[model samples]
Target: MGSVQHLPYSVSNHCPLLVNKESNRSSLRDQRFYFEAWWTLDDSFEGTLTDIWESSSAPLVEKLKIVQIGLKKWARDLKFNKGDKKRRLTKELEILLMDDMDEETLKIHLNIEIDKDEVYWEQRARTNWL
Candidate 1:
């Protein structure tokens, strides 16, 4: 009888090391890309705000008061957004559990769906450009 070779799944197609290396490189690239894009976008927005403030005829105190009010509103909105997300996740988890799903499975699903929304502000912050 001829002996059969049992090739590993990864080796049968390609090297495992190469696959891991590519994945790591892609992840790093994505991180760097997002960081740079975020920084540039932030700088542009700040510059625009500074220009507007510098050119405004409003008194300094009035401008400051307006900015303070805006900031407070922004902070409140951020808190509300976070709370809403948490509530949604909790509701979904409860439904899943009520359907006899395991805790771990529910957690994984909730985390994946809820985590994507954590960056909502980065996009919403641009609306302040006016």
Candidate 2:
């Protein structure tokens, strides 16, 4: 502790840098299931909901738990399935673009893929929709 030098930065500065980095990274992901209003467009989704709502003989609370479990499973499954489909379509687009093809047909497929991408995003951004 003999010499005192004028330093450009302090330990405090680096501390906040480390703190900010840790604070910005979340360890837990959101796991709650949210019902997609858009799923009603699927003919089978309504029927499945009705079945889950009616098939349980348990009282109100228990019935609700069952339906919640069913829907959670359904939504989780849909998430995985749709995620895979989207990835597949994205890869397909990449591959298609790399090769030569008829412009008219490629445009049609591109439009379809774009629509799928939109729907995929719509499902994920439910909170922002409200």
Candidate 3:
């Protein structure tokens, strides 16, 4: 008997094997159902601390001070490569000092005064008066 040969969809009168009408309709319906389900869920999301800080009633200068303090603490605690230790330390110190000045400027702008003696006394107490 001669070997059977399959004809291309265009040449064949029968519907193409790849084109399954039922499966396509079901897939589209499933996608639409999932989209509608997701849309029905709650849209509200909680704001993070940074978001709240940025939107806070606090003055811009105070916000900048808080950011500076955070940056300084990050720099102080970060680990640097041994080879670049000195350079990293120098850069960190310079940046931290600049941030400190920015924080002080913010304090001045806010008219929030700090007592140096009181701060010193507190530090002394923390160190057991040593």
Q: Model 2 compared with the native: what TM-score?
A: 0.44
On a 0 to 100 scale, what is the lDDT of residue 99 in model 3?
Answer: 73
Clashing pairs in 2: none
Can you rank all candidates by TM-score, best first? 2, 1, 3
Of candidates 2 and 1, the better by lDDT: 2
Angstrom error of the Cα, residue 22, model 1: value is 67
lDDT of 2 by residue, 1-130 (tens): 1223344556565432212324322333344445666455444678889999999899999998888888877766765676565567566767777785545654654565456557657777765666
Residue 91, candidate 2: alpha-carbon lDDT: 69
lDDT tens digits, residues 1-130, model 3? 1233444677658854443334345556543411111111112112222554565566888886665554334333421222254355456556768777444443432221123234434554666556
Candidate 3 Cα misplacement greater than 4 A, ranges: 1-57, 80-130
The candidate, 1 or 2, that scores higher on TM-score is: 2
TM-score for each candidate, following the candidate numbering: 0.26, 0.44, 0.20
lDDT comparing candidate 1 with the true structure: 0.52
State, as a TM-score between 0 and 1, how close model 1 is to the true structure: 0.26
What's the CA error at residue 104 for candidate 2, in Å?
Answer: 15
